[model samples]
Each structure stands twice: as structure tokens, then as C-alpha cells.
Target: MDWMHEHELRRVNQIKLSLPSSGEEALAARERIQKRIAARRAARTPAAA
Candidate 1:
């Protein structure tokens, strides 16, 4: 079980390391997603309120 966990962790780390986005691109994507999520939440709240 421990070995399986270690293998999975290594695989995940490798994939993360290999991803194409530079730090700025990742941050920009995250910010865009957060803004979209916040806008959706705001839209839902007033209707429910």
C-alpha cells in the first residue's frame, strides 16, 4: 500500500513538472477562473436573497 502511494505521488509530481504553463500563465488562468466563479456566485445570491 505504501509503495502504491509513493508511485502515485511520483507520477503526479512528474506530470506537474512537465506541464507547459509558466508561473504567470498559471496565475492568470487561476485569476480568470476565480473571477468567473465569483460572478456566478454573485448572480445566484441576489436571486436567492
Candidate 2:
């Protein structure tokens, strides 16, 4: 989880630096990263009995 968070942070930073003019673009990037991370976590967890 720590690694995943770090990776997401890195991606966010990259997006921020690459396009410093658009807040909306940054927000969209963050949302996409978050959804991907959430989906990965959900897939890794065991199903309830």
C-alpha cells in the first residue's frame, strides 16, 4: 500500500509538472489515479465468507 501510494503521488507530481496551467487537468489525473488504485486494492482483497 505504501508503494502504491508513493507511485500515485509520483504520477500526480508528473502530471502537475507537465501541465502547470490547468487545475482541471490535474484534478482529472488525480481522479483517474485514485480509481485505478482503488480498483487494484479491491481486486487484491479476499472475498467475505
Candidate 3:
């Protein structure tokens, strides 16, 4: 009955898909965050040649 429709299921599945569900996925997410932090830092300072 309810399983026939995908309204709520679709929303929940989207949330689940966005989460890091494994160690490798979690590591990748962490690396991405670190890269963002480094980029911000790099943007705020003068570079030396």
C-alpha cells in the first residue's frame, strides 16, 4: 500500500545517500573539508616567491 508510493521514501533515501556510510566515505569527506580550510587560509595571506 504505502510502499507503492515514493514521496516520503524518496526524501529519506536522498538524506541517506548524502551521508557518509563507510570508513572510506568518511575519510573522503574529511579530506574535502581539510582542503576547503587550506584554501581559505591560502586566500587570506600574501604569498612568497
Winner by TM-score:
1
TM value for model 1: 0.55
Question: Which of the two, 2 or 3, has more TM-score?
Answer: 2
Q: List model 3 lDDT by residue over 1-49, tens digit each.
A: 4664688888888998888679878899999999999998888765641
RMSD of 2: 16.0
How much is 45 displaced in model 2, in angstroms? 0.4
Per-residue lDDT value at 34 in model 3: 100
> Per-residue error at 48 for model 2, in Å?
11
Q: What are the Cα lDDT values of the candidates?
A: 0.89, 0.82, 0.83
Task: Order the candidate numbers by TM-score, best to worst.
Answer: 1, 2, 3
Count of steric clashes across candidates, in order = 0, 0, 0
Off by over 4 Å in 1: 1-21
Q: List the residue pairs that clash in candidate 1.
A: none
Query: Per the 3 Å backbone cut-off, how many clashing residue pairs does candidate 3 have?
Result: 0
Which wins on lDDT, candidate 1 or candidate 3? 1
